[model samples]
Target: MTGWRRRETKREEQIIRVLQEPPEAIDLRGARRWRWADEHWRVWLRRSATGVELFTRWQESDEYRYMLGDDAYQMQLIEILTRATPRDCAAAGFGCTRRMDRACSEPSICSRDPLPAAGVDPHREGPVPGGCDSFYGGDDVRVRFSAGNRHQAVRWSMSLWIDGVRVGAGLRLASSGWWLDDRFFVVPAEGPDEHPAQEYTMGDLVSVIHSVLIHDAALSVTRVLVPGPEEMWTEPWVVRDGDELRVYPDQETSRGPDRTIVLTD
Candidate 1:
C-alpha cells in the first residue's frame, strides 16, 4: 500500500539563474580533483592539466560548475590544495557577493540583485567577513550580518551595506535581521554581555530578554528599550499602528516604553 499524501498548495515559482558557459581557457577534461566538504559549503577544484581550469561549488548549487577564468583564483585554489587540511579550507579566502548555498536553494534566487563582476567591491572595501549567517535583500541594497553566537561574549565584526558602502562601521553582537524596505532594516538584537543576576525574579541568564535595533538609509541607528525591563523579558509583539510599526513589551499590554519605530520614508 502507498503512504498517505497531502495536497500541494499553489505557490509562486522562482526563477533560477543559469551560470554562463565556461571559456575555452578552462578545459575540464583530465583535471585533478581536490575536494573539501563542510557544513555550509561543499567545495572542490578541477585543476587543468595544461591550463587554468578551477571550479568552485561554493559560488552556487551543486548542479552547475562555476569557474573563474582569472589565473589569480586558480593559484589561490592550488595553494589551498597543497596544504590539504581542514584548517586551510576554513581559512581560504574565496570572495563573491554570495556563497550561494545555505538558506536559499539557488544563489540567483537568494540574491535579489545582479552580482557585481568578479573581485569587485560590491559591499565595502578590503575582504568580506567570515562566517556570514544569512543574506537579506540584494547586492544593491542589502543587509549581511552574522547571528547565533549566543555562547560567545564577543563575535566577529559585522555591518550592513548599501550600494557598495558600509553602514555604521560594524557591530560585534550577533543578531537576526529583516530588510523591511530599501532604507530600513530591523533586528531582534541580542542584549549586552553582562546582565546582573539580582535584577530579575528568575535571575539574569534564566530570564528571557528582548530588544530591537533599527537602521535607516542615512546610517542612523535607533535602538528600542535595549536590554528591556527587569523581569519583563517576554517576547514583544509587533503591530501595525497607522503608518508606523509599534512593538509592545508583551502581548498583555500596549503600554510600556513605546518601542515605536517610524516607518515613513
Candidate 2:
C-alpha cells in the first residue's frame, strides 16, 4: 500500500481546477484591429467583447495568436509594444530555413555555431561556434528563442508571455504550439509521473496527457489539462476544427479515445 498521499501545492491545485473546466472564451467578432511592428516582428491587436485578440507575424514568416481579456490589459499591452526594440540576434533567424535544414543534419554543430548574415553560410568555418537569436512578442503576447545547447540533446523549454510581458512558468514539449482560435494556444507538455521511469509498450502509453497547457490570454492565465487516474495519453496532438478542439495521439495504431472540448460558450 502507498504510505501517505502527498498534498497538492497551490499550483497543483490550480492545475487540477483548470483540467476539470477550462476558462471561458470571449467572442472576438467585430473587434477592431490595431497594428504594431519593429525590425523583427509585426503585431496585430483586436479588442473583443470582453478582452483583446493579439496576432504575431514573425519576420515575414509564420503567424500565431494570443487572446487577452479584461479592459486594462489592452492599454498595458500597447505601452509595452510601443517601447519594444529588436535584438541584434533577431535578424539571424529570418531566413535560416535552408540553414536550419542543413544544421539539423548535425544539430549539435548547428545549434552551437555562430549565425551568419541572411545570404551567408554558417557552416563555412567548420561548425559555427556559440549561440544564436532572440524573439519578442507584441500586444498581450510574448515570444522567446533559444540558442540550442551543445552538450545535451536539444529540447525546448516552455516560456509564457502575457500582456506583452514574459512570465517564466509555461511548459512545452517537442515544440508543440497549436492555436485553438483567435485567442487560445495549446501546448502538450510533461506532467506528474508517479510510475517509475522504464520502457513501456506503445499500447500502454495512449489515452494519457501528462498535461495539456492552454493559455487564456483573455484571463492572462495558463491552464492545464490532465488525464483521469487510469489512462495516460502519450504524444498527444491538439487540433482545432471549427468550434471544437480535439486531443489525440498522432500515431495511427494507438487505441485511445480522442478528447474533445467545445469552444463555443
Candidate 3:
C-alpha cells in the first residue's frame, strides 16, 4: 500500500509540473493574437475599441530564424538607401550590384558582412566597387565596397540640399559588416515643366553608383532635383552625391520640411 501510494504521489507531482509550466502551444483568440501558421510564427496587430493591440506567435525553429534574418537584411537595405548620404553610400557601397550578389549569397551571412569595401573583389564581373543612382523604395540595395579594415561598424552620412543650398546633414550607424536599412525623400522644383519627380529605387541605383565611385574613381551625381507632385507645394528629396553639398533644409521650416526617415524592422 505504501509503495502504491508513493507511486501515485509521484504521478500527481509530474502532472502538476506539466500544468504549472507555461504552455508550449498558445491559444490566440484575443484582439491582437499571433499563432503558429504554416510552420511559422504569425504576428498580428489589430485595432481595438480603445486603441491598438499587438500579438505574436512564438516558434522555435531554424527556418524561422532564417526568415527573420532575411527580413532584417531587407530592412537594413531600406534604411541605408533612405538615410545614408552620398559619402556614406559610396563608402558603404549602397548600390553596388556585384557586391550585392556576394552579400546575398549563402556564405556572406547578412549579419556578419553586410557590404564589401572599395577595391575588394566582390567575386563577380562588371565593376569592383558599386554606385548609387537614385533613391527609390525597395527591400534590396546592393553594397559593393568593403567596410574598410576596421570591420567594426557600418557608417553613412546624408547632406540635404535645396536649390543647391545646403540645409542639413545626417549620420547613420549600423552593425559591423552589416548593412543598415534606411530611406530617403527628395523634392525637386515645384513646376509643371520640370522632369516629373523621378523615383529611383535603391536596388536600381546601387550598381551604377558603386562602379562609378569605387572603380572608376569618379565622384558622380547620384541624385537630381525634379518637379515634385502637383498636389504638394514643396517636396523634400534625398540627394546622393560624391562630394557633400553645402545647402540643405531647415528642420523647423513650416513648409513641411520635417522628414521622417527610419529603418523598418
Candidate 4:
C-alpha cells in the first residue's frame, strides 16, 4: 500500500485528466510503458454514463472476498473527516457558491483544519503491512484509530500523538454512535442530545457524523448510530486532555433555530 501513493506518473496524470472529462474506454497499452512491470494498481477506472467510477477493483481478484469485508461506513470516514457544513465555512469567512446547500465546497478558504488536530500528513511514513489495520496513525503517531462497527455498542477507544511518535495516553468508554477504533485508539462520536420521546433517527445522527468527522462538532458529544437504525445510541468519547488532543465545541456548529441540545446547547 506504501507504493500505491508514489505510482502517479505522467501516464496516470494523463489517464486521470482524461477520466475527469468524458465517459470512454481507455487504452491501457500506453499507460503500461510508463511503469515498471512491478508497478501495480489496485484501483479501476470505469466509464459511466455520468462520468467515472474510481475504486479498488477487486471483484475478480483472489482477495475479492477479503476486500469485500471492508465496511462501507468505515470507508467514508475520509470524506467525512474533511467535510464541513456550509454554515461552518460561511462563519469562518466564506460565501456560498450555491444557496441553501448544507455542505461547503471550498474547505481551502477556511483557516481551520478541524479533524482532531491539524497538519495530518496524508502520506504515511513507513512500509505498510499486507494485512494492516483499517485505521492507521501516521508517523508512529501519538494518535490512534481503529476499525469499528456501528452494531457493537459499548466498545471503542482513543489516543493522542504527543511528540515525535510518542503516543500519549488513551481513553475508552463505549456505548453508542460511530467510532474510529483500531484496537489501540478509539474515538467515539456522541449522538444528538435529543430527548428519548422525540424519535431522532439514524439519518439525523449520520448528518451529525458528517460534522463529527470534520472535527467540527462537540467532542464530549461524540456518538454513533448502532446496528442498523435500531437507535441504540452510545457515547464513546474518552480521551485524555492534552495539547496533542483537545476536545471542545465546534465554533462553526449551528443547529437550526432555538437549539437546546442539553449535552451541547
Candidate 5:
C-alpha cells in the first residue's frame, strides 16, 4: 500500500482546475501553471478562454491525442511542432530505437571476444589477457568526448548530440546502451544555415557518423564523449578504425596511467 499522499497546494488545485474547466483569457494572463509530462501522457498546459486547457499525447503513437474542452492548457499551433515531429527510426537494426533522454548507462557492460562461439553469454567478467571483455561501473553519469567528422558517440548537459544533431537517450547496442538522457549537444553549422538538432536512433547515429566521416570530411568530432562499453570510466578506448566503427572493450580508463583522461561515473 502507498503511504499517505501529500495534500495538493493551492497552486496545484489551480493547475488541476485549469485542466478540467478552463478559465477565461483574463484568468490565463494571471494564472501560472507548470507543464505536466510523464512516460504515459506527455501532458501540457496552455492559455485558453479565461483560464487554461489540458492536452496530452501518447509517446508510442503519434495519431493519438486527448483534449478536454474549449478552454485549453496546451501550446498553440506554433509550439506544437516539437510534439508533432515523428521519431526517426529508419536505421534501427538488431536493436531497439530509443529517445536519447531515456537511455540507461548501466555500469556493467557485457563484452565478448570479437568473434565468440555461437551461444556464450558476453558477460564473462575477466578477459583472457588479450581477448574480448565486459566491464562494470556506477549508473547515472555523462561522458564527454572531443570528436570530429570521423565521428564518435556524443553527449551534453540535457541533450544527446550525434554528428551535430540531437538524439534520444537510447543508443542501444547488443546488450545495453548509454544513459545520455538530459545530456546536451550542438549541431555544426553547414553552409549558410545552422543545423537543427533532433533525436536519432542507434542505427541513425551509426549512419550519421558514417556519413560525416565519408562526406563531411571537413568536420571533426570536436569535444566528443566517446561511447565506451558499459564498463567504461576514464578508460582509454582501443578504437579500431575500419569500414565499421569498433570500440574495443578495455578497462584502461580506470587503471590506465595518469596521462589518460580520468572521469567518474
Candidate 6:
C-alpha cells in the first residue's frame, strides 16, 4: 500500500537548494551582471528549523551614487546584510526580518530649518536656534541662526523673489526664550487670480527676507505674532520692527506691541 504524500515541486527544490547553501559558497565569478540589476556579491543561507535567507551587495556605480547619496546607499546596505533571529523573522513573515522592516520604516534624519515666508523679519542670524527645515515636494530649503551665548538672540530675514524679481520678505526671530518667531508677507504672483494653487514648480523664484542678526537681547526685538497670508489661515506671522504696518488684498491685518512692518515701493 502506498501512503499519500504531497511532494515538493521542482521550483521548491530549487529554492531549498539556494537556501540550504551558505551564501559565501555561491559562485558569482565571471557572471554577466548588469550594473543596475545584478548584485556584485551575494550570500544564501537556511535556518536549521525555519525558512531561507538571501543577502546581496551591489557595486556602487556612479549612476547609483548620483541617484541615491552615499549615506543613503550605505544605510540600505546595512539594512539588508544584517540578519535577525528565526523567531523574529518568522513573526514578520517569510523572507522578511524585523530589523530590515524597522530600518526601512525609519524616517529620514536631517539637520536643516525652515525659512520665513516673504516680507516678515525675525530680526535676529547663524542657525535658527531650534528651527528645522521642512520638506515639501522635492524642495529642500531652510534658514537658521545660532547665538554665541545662551542669553543672546539670533534673527533671520528672508527675501521673496518671483521670476527673479524681488516680491516680498519674511523675518524669523530666535532667542534663548523662544527658538522661532515666524512672520510672512503676501506678494501676489501675477496679481492674484481667483483660482490660486499651492503647487511650486521649477523656476518659480521665491526668496526670503533681507537681514538676520545675532546679538544681545536688548538689541533684539521682543516676541510678537504676525499673521501669515490670507490663504494660509492658521500659520501665524510676526514682525520685529515696532512702528510700521501694511495691508494686502483679501487679507486682514493685525499689529502687536513688539512687531512692525516696513513696506517698500
lDDT of 3 by residue, 137-233 (tens): 1232222222232111122222232222232232111111111112222223213333244332233221111101111112212233222343222
Question: Model 2: per-residue lDDT, tens digit, 1-265?
Answer: 1333334365688878889985444433212122222212211112111112222223221322233434344444344332322221222222122333221122244333244341132112223333222232322232322222111111123344434444336443434344444355565656546533322333322223455666655455565776545445555566656677666655443554467878654
Rank order by lDDT, top first?
A: 2, 1, 3, 6, 4, 5
lDDT of 1 by residue, 19-112 (tens): 3444344334323222222223332122222111222322222233235544444334333233222112222223322442223233222222
The deviation in Å at residue 176 for candidate 5 is 9.6
Once model 5 is optimally superposed onto the true structure by TM-score, how far is the C-alpha of residue 68 displaced, in angstroms? 15
Candidate with maximal lDDT: 2
TM-score of each: 0.35, 0.37, 0.19, 0.20, 0.19, 0.17
Off by over 4 Å in 5: 1-25, 34-160, 163-265
Question: Order of candidates by TM-score, top first?
Answer: 2, 1, 4, 5, 3, 6
lDDT winner, 1 or 2 = 2
Model 6 per-residue lDDT at 138:
10
Candidate closer to the true structure by lDDT (higher is better), 2 or 5: 2
CA RMSD per model (angstroms) = 18.2, 20.2, 18.7, 18.3, 19.9, 19.0
lDDT per prediction?
0.34, 0.38, 0.27, 0.26, 0.24, 0.26
Off by over 4 Å in 6: 1-10, 25-265
Instruction: Give Cα distance to truth, residue 254, candidate 1, Å.
Output: 7.8
lDDT of 6 by residue, 206-226 (tens): 212111221123233322222
- Model 4 agreement with the true structure over 1-265: per-residue lDDT tens digits: 5577557575689878998986544456434332311112111112121111112121122244355554543333223222322122233222222322222233233222233322122211111211111121122111122232111111113322211121212322122222222121333433444534224335323323211221212232232222223233232232222223322333222321111122222
Question: Among these predicted structures, which one has the highest TM-score?
Answer: 2
The ten-residue window of minimal lDDT in model 2 covers 147-156
lDDT of 5 by residue, 68-137 (tens): 3222312231123222211111010001122234321221221111233312322222222111121111
